[model samples]
Target: MKKVALVSLISIFIAITVLSGCSSNNTSENTSKVENTATNDASTNQTKTNDTAVTNETTTEQGVPEKYDPPIEMTTVGVNYPTVKFSEGESRTDNVWTRAYLDKFGIKLNYKWVVDDTQLEQKTNLMLSTGEIPDFMNVTDIQFKQLYDAGLIEDLTDVYEKYASESVKRMMTAGGPIAMDSAKFNGRLMGIPYTMSNKEVADVIFIRQDWMDKLGLPAPKSMQDVLAISEAFTTKDPDGNGKADTFGLAADKGMTMLNGFINGYHAYRDLWIKDSTGNLVYSDIQPEMRAALQALQGMYKSKQLDQEFSVKEFAKVSESLAASKVGILYYPPYGGSYPLQSVRDNNPSSDWTAYPLPSIDSTPAAPQVGASTNGYWVVKKGYEHPEAILKIMDFWIKTFYENKSREVMEKYVTTPDGNTPWLLSAIFSYEGFFNVDVQQDIKAVIEGSKKFDDINPIAQDTYTKVMNFVERKDEKFWGFDEVYGLHGARAITKEVYLANNLFTENQFYSTATQTMGVKMATLQKMRDVAFTKIITGAPIEEFDQFVESWNKSGGEQITKEVNDWYKSK
Candidate 1:
């Protein structure tokens, strides 16, 4: 009976696999035929001409010879962002668009682990330390370097250059590929890179619009205007409770608010420099930091910031803002969503909107553009069919380009009139092939998409949200566009558009992508202590002392290390 039960399980598994159309056979050569049949069955919407273009361009028609079943699985690991949900019971095995395309190519996905959004770094470190390393891992810069130095990761320079599909190769040339160079150690690619857009935009300050109107105040247009507005909202008690319980600004003490205040000053909290030739060098150690510290001390002394902020976790920042107690917040438009969305849901009459970050010197400083770090699928070294993984990747390019699968097209394709098919398409028609059109559309909208009178409220809301962000050009606060667009609704907005621009072509070493685990661990503590004290106004004079302590406690070393890594690249 036990044997029969085992046999029954195997049979059931096979049936499910067949019905789902994903083959996990023992040879690489079977990949092409399987993928072809699946693609044909999956969709009939694709024109033959378009599909032929995919087949011919991808070399899917004649790349690997027939008859061999690919025998390998690519292991991937990353934080579980909302867009890439992997719940064991809820997630579909073959239902994922990317996985279905790979089924045709005879490659299998084996996830190493799924971590909560907040605890990703911690879980990743535990995995690394235990040496229970999976075949591939999506790690930060600190982790990448540590693993490479420990010789746990294989170099992919030759493989990437020689075997990377045309689509992947093309992406490498579109600027910021220099970041891939950061993963290079002793002249070899240590890991595959996850990519993000390089377009730049600043964070915006969002306020409760209803409060502004209630107080008969217009939107803030300058730094002093913002301060006055904040003061009024806090001290004037716009909420009508008549209690002095309001915080003027909702800042998580340690985090920098410069991005939301990008209207005029090119500020630096960490290691900015000025060239002898009069260029503003990156300024972690500048006199400007002193002035910035002084301003922050004043805010703390005035009790304008959240007093309980030091104990807040990163995710909870939204909670405080959403409660309608935070009169002022600094973030991108979408960043305002948690609070705004809650307000909209619980009280649709709630009026809230975003505005540009404040300017210090009346010039837009360089926005912080987060280095491109994204989900990447990579193969294990010595896998019997490494070619299978390459073929799988090639299959994705074809699948997305040809828009072949009905399942995907139904989900993702939104017509100009906004008609969506039942399935999801990985390639959005509005987004286009290179992702540049989407970028342009965002910019165009921020310049004014609201002018169209017949726009849907959802679209209008999106536009309002996005436009609130576009007015600022600082890139640091605008890193999450692709994820937001892919995960959020189809409606375009100024913030989304500006975020699209922030993801353009530049080559900075992504500190987030490097594997500097030890450095990160040390820095977190120092960051917590220093930021809290600075924001709470422990003392203005102690800032210099804090900086000194921060340096002694590894902040300086990390900076030097990062610079060294940058120079080496």
Candidate 2:
């Protein structure tokens, strides 16, 4: 009995030990499975995160993404025009304009150097000679050609097509193919042309309405009317000062009689116009130019023009206008804000008005205006990112015109003096950037669909000025009254544009021809001397000799080259 009981206990103890070993094996297997599951879950999560990151990067690289991931640093040289003013603690590199580029596009515009407008060409040439070209820079037509000849600038054809925004493309073609054509060399786009609106070049006759009122003369509608008005302004003592101290017309040494006077006689100087033979003829040599010169000579003889005008520079002429020594002038629409502004500020009672150039006979004068391609923006060769420049331009147009963001307006457009600053960017704007806007605002104001506050910020400032002047809220707003108020200069420009009376210059040569490049300065000097001499009592027959001499000295070659270029286009 005792032996049987001991065997039972031993058997029980062995069974219990076997059960515990089995339980231990099960726990180990469960622990291994859990560890494997956690590892797989972590791996899956990491893979998903990486895929999302790659997708975001791809999206940014593909379309017109507003920002970059890693960010890009672009270097450029900018022109610091004397007219450009910065607030305290702001600079070309640290201003709102530069910061906007960085914040929006991840582009850090580091200026390699900045120089005033006067020194831009000189400094740029020096940079080119030393092979230290910045990433991008604005260059004149001649400088653009020079860079092209040296193969130092990139051909932007492909990049522009691929990356340019739709708005930019539309604006580039706004003035027809001329703006784009100016930037193309041999079929490749080497630079982006900065164009002025066609309306900007349309010349207008600016005269003192007060003087006309004083003399009881009608607004000029013809060359004869203009002559009569000029005589009356000069001899009638329209200023009521009772002295022969004022001249009928204001002219600078560079452009005699201004563009309006020349256009009034149906004559154009330094422009290309179609002749009766349907070929382009240089206007300086045209017969109508001689007739205009004869008219100017007669005016000089009658003391209707400034006697010492030949020696007066633009500044001197502007001073004369401010001092109330001149009553009539010819200028563009914006002239109201410039030299004419001085006139208004000096004599608050002076009322200046703008009119289309008077007719020579029954036909009204259609003044010839050319697209002012001031310069171009170009990228240096071998730059890693040529599209960056286009991107910058895209932002500019959108900010100013398309987006019309209030933040941008407050930060960039508005000045401390409650005025608006003109384009403060390094890039050039499209032609007619604000013509349509101004017209729309003017219409809206007239129709009562929009208040001054509802218009664009820049236009709003203009509206404010116009209102202040019209309501006589401020005496200083007289210039604005003349320019933007009801029946102002802009009205005249808009009317001319709508009537299709504006004549654009036919020549589209972006750079000077080979012969012209060398001899143009000389030829222009000769023409100026001859024109001055003829106007200042020299023989009128000297013009024929001057034309002959001009044609002989490289003018014929230039004409041939120009025609060849036109034909190629």
Candidate 3:
């Protein structure tokens, strides 16, 4: 019966894959054909192209060749996160994943150095400044721009076009052209962009359903409703602890309001939005922001917001949530797993549900979301085999997603402890990968064509946790249920996507402008201070003065530079 079930599941997946215009049978053969076509095309175009840098070098057509005639040595630098664990004898440079790369593609990875997450940016900056760049390294947008400007990184346009696997190309551009566009400078692709779905940034309001139920209030639909709820949550003692300690909202100094509370008033602080004339304007200085600040002032004065919020850090704020001291927060979809998970662990009775932000009036709240592309992969200017990076990425995508062989899945995909092996490959995947798959499986399950057990392992794990919560099998699985279950955070994101309510950041400048690079930090500090002061009861009039001061203190120049960059784009 188990074998039959496995075969049935594979058949279903194959059908789905075929419908998506991908072959589920013999991925290796398909990969080889793609590789051969790319290589032939590169050879044919080599003579006609004007790029003198690329020579007519004979290259293997196989995406992951059995072995190179002579093994290729590549050096890179990566963050060795503290949480990453190695097996008994495996090290960063010779781990199971790295060894697989060597065995499959004849690529030997040598780490110039592995730094902790804290030191990655500083050390990479130092390396770039001193011209000690490795063969390939992951770099921030600013560093990528700097390297392109300095002519220290290879123009990967031709190499990537010739060598990247079709699956990779599709995945990189799946979200939109923005991912690839961000990596381009002057119409030439300089780096491999780390792509993520724009939907990942969609903001939602997470409220304690139990608290609402206790107070006999409906889910909020307008700013007025939210305010009334806040007032009630603050005064009614919904936690039932018989103490007047609970508040309405959670906030931290790092991000004063997580999803930009000002967005509820159609004001996006620290973001760029278009005015009625379609001219780009900074959100912080707008009149809408003044109204938002005034509203926050009212909340603070009414004791609906935390009085000590200005001084609270993220950990402290999360602790307050875990202790049931706060009942509302604006956060991204992933909040179900992190701080909210801790809340479930601490107070199992708490029930959180996500809702779209309430509008100030009849106009729906369109919150401004931002990009999630953290970094990119770039090869040194003179690396002999820039395509090696793409080849490694091809291997990762194939092994991680397409490979259905049980042996490969059990050995390479999962660790000995039955956890997913963190690939940390130098490639980006669509942020919506798992959620999109889960959503599809959900539809299939609803239609009686699939079961939760038939989904991918990660989704299956999530399903198990959700079932555990729904069936009351475990209290700890409540967070998983809230995040990955049928009516969870992912569902809310899907709704936002379907409703066309998601708004992306207008600014696509990958790096800071000249004036912005120098003045942005100081300006942000000033903005934070002004916002905190205004929220904590400094006269609301102070916001106008701060706006005036901002323009004078390089804000005008920065705005001009940003607009100039936008026009160039």
lDDT of 1 by residue, 388-483 (tens): 445544545444433433333323222222232112212111011122233333434445652422332222223333433344432221222311
Worst 10 residues of 3 by lDDT: 33-42
Instruction: Identify the candidate with maximal TM-score.
Output: 3
Q: After superposing candidate 1, which stretches have Cα over 4 Å from the reference? A: 1-103, 106-143, 146-155, 162-166, 169-175, 197-202, 214-218, 240-245, 253-259, 262-265, 268-285, 313-320, 374-388, 394-406, 409-524, 553-560
TM per candidate comes to 0.62, 0.81, 0.82
Cα RMSD (Å) per model? Answer: 12.3, 25.9, 12.0
Clashing residue pairs in candidate 2 (N, C-alpha, C atoms within 3 angstroms): none
lDDT of 2 by residue, 362-385 (tens): 877877665445567889899988
lDDT of 3 by residue, 271-365 (tens): 76667876667888999888988988888888877888777776677778878899888875556655677777787777899887788988778
Stretches of model 2 off by over 4 angstroms after superposition: 1-64, 80-95, 417-426, 430-436
Task: Give all candidates' CA lDDT scores.
Answer: 0.46, 0.66, 0.65
Total clashing residue pairs per candidate? 66, 0, 0
Better of 1 and 2 by lDDT: 2
